[model samples]
Target: MGIVVIKLGGSLIQGLSNTFFEHINLLQRNGKKVIIVHGGGPLINNLLLKFSIPVEMEDGLRKTSNEVLEVVEYALNGKTNKDLVIMCNQFNLSAIGLSGCDNLLLEASLYDKGKLGWVGEVENVNTSLLELLLTNDYLPVISPIGVDKIGQKYNINADLAAKSIAKALNAEVLCYVTNTNGVLNSEGKSIEKITKDQVQALIESKTITDGMIPKVQSALDALDEVQSVAIVGENFLNEDGSMNGTVFTKGVVFSE
Candidate 1:
């Protein structure tokens, strides 16, 4: 069965449409194994505010201090992960919630010499565990919180974490589920397809800005390993199996 990795943006978690879950069901019916990596930025920020802890970010990545890491873990693993699992189960998808730290699902190393304090980049992914779950027909919903060899936990950017997992699994498709339908042009229209080469140009032209930069960049990065990458919203996959989103390809126009 082909594997698909979906990266769900935290902003869209609370409002994901039924159509989104239905599309997941459709993928399963088509014999695809699905895995999900999710972010909890909004929830984390809320908890941080509730605790009066200053929320900090650098280059679109949350700057995680020791105290901030605790909140991040609680919001991501404790709340967001379970919420997504429940949503999946409600849609008749057998979803298993997990943290990147669980069973060493995602091993990591400190990023930028700990400049982003407690933030890390994925060094490895436990594909064996994933395969075992997928083999049993269970969808794994992963929270992007990683741990190092010495038991030190680190916060991982969900988009980058998904890219790492997709690369490790050599997934057939890597989809970033965002609030927007897809990458939008300056005219505010969704571009149906974008080549890897076009990504940098779009960024340069300021068409893709702010939060979308990382999502688009991560999609571009995953294109080297995954056959296809897309940035899409809830109404992404169609009944006919075609996708509606900004598809990233390696110089070839997307056909289906």
Candidate 2:
């Protein structure tokens, strides 16, 4: 079977929700190959503030300096990645945590250094290492950090990293475990299903503003390759066991 690349948000990882681990176990038991790409932005930010590294943000993404990137790598790969591995183990799910630089799994180029310093855009995603782990029934937990050919480290956006890995592995599902209750309307209710065209309108009207813009954009980018991209409401999951999420697909129309 192919993989299901799940991009677990930084917030989700921090909360240490048992429900998240339960869902992952279910996926594993169902014979689904799962790979987790996680972010540690909040953790990194907190640590940076503690160290007084002077962090900044623009359009929901952290504008990382070299000092900031160092803290990001340490917190993400060293701390958070290992923590997630431990959590998965407690759930009886064997996990091997890694970063993109481990085996050159994800090659990337700098993404607009003028604005976002040391942030990388994934140029290539080789999934052989991930496949091997999955084939052996081990869940591969990944930190969003890539490297160049000469071994220069770069911080890849979790959303983009997940999408790239999903597309590369031809994953059956790409799920974005997000903070909100799915995509909200002007009235602030969760919209269950949204198409590419509708997304454009939402952006234009500012209904899907802020950090949600990248979530939607990543979903749209993955739709061309993956089976489907699910913008799931993590909050809704806490309220009801059922997945209250918006499904993004290629042929989805407004009528659905």
Candidate 3:
């Protein structure tokens, strides 16, 4: 079985329906090994507000300060990760929740201590445990938090973390399950498929902007490492296995 890494954003967690888990089950039933890396933005922000800490975002990524990093960990690891794991168990998926800081699974240094504060760019992914868990048929739900050599923890962008892990595991595809349908064209319609060249063209044309731009660009970068990448809405995957999303490939794009 091949690996499939999913980057599930916190923003979409509340809206995830039973149908979504069914689709995940469908993937597993078809012999696809699934791993999940998730974010907890809304939850983090809420906690930050509850504690009177100002929330900051830079270039679609969170600007995590030491103070905010604590809250981020609480949201991602303590709350969101456990929630997803329980949800998977409820569906008989049998999930194990983990953090990049667990057993040095992911090692990293600060991305830019000055710019993004405690944000991290994954320097290395330790795939041994991951492979072991996958071999045992357990889905790993990962919290995107990395630790440095000196035992300093940094918040990692879930998408980038998922991409690095996917590349390390040689996953068949890395999928971003977001709230939107997919990358849209100028007319606000989901583009069926896209190549790297077309992604650049779309970026230059300003058709992809705001949060969606960063997501597609992240997927574009991940495409170089993974066989294929996709950005789709939570419901984009149908019971029939047809999908509504923009797929990015290295060369010419084609429907499966």
Best of the candidates, TM-score: 1
Whole-model lDDT, model 1: 0.90
What overall lDDT, based on C-alpha atoms, would model 2 receive against the true structure?
A: 0.83
Give me the displacement of residue 29 in model 3, in angstroms.
Answer: 1.2
Where is the poorest 10-residue window by lDDT in model 1? 236-245
Top-lDDT candidate index: 1
* Candidate 1 off by > 4 Å: 252-256
Ranking, TM-score, top scorer first = 1, 3, 2
Candidate 1: deviation at residue 154, Å? Answer: 0.9
Clashes of 2: 0
TM-scores for candidates 1 onward, in order:
0.94, 0.91, 0.92
Candidate 2 Cα outliers beyond 4 Å, as residue runs: 235-243, 251-256
- Candidate 2 residue 234 C-alpha distance from true site, Å: 3.2
Structure candidate 3, residue pairs in collision: none
lDDT of each: 0.90, 0.83, 0.86
Compute the lDDT of residue 43 as modeled in candidate 2. 89
TM-score of candidate 3 relative to the true fold: 0.92
Candidate 3 lDDT, tens digit per residue, 1-256?
5898988978988768998788788889889899999988889989999999998886578888889999999999898999999998899998999999998887988886548899898989989999999989999999999997889998988888888899899898788988778888888898888887888888789886655666777788887678878999887575666565878867855789
For model 1, how does the per-residue alpha-carbon lDDT over 1-256 read when each residue is reduced to its tens digit?
Answer: 5999999999989988898898899899989999999998889999999999998886578888999999999999999999999999999999999999989999999999999899999999999999999999999999999998889999999999999999999999999988888999889999998986777888888887777877888888888789988888878786677777888877856678
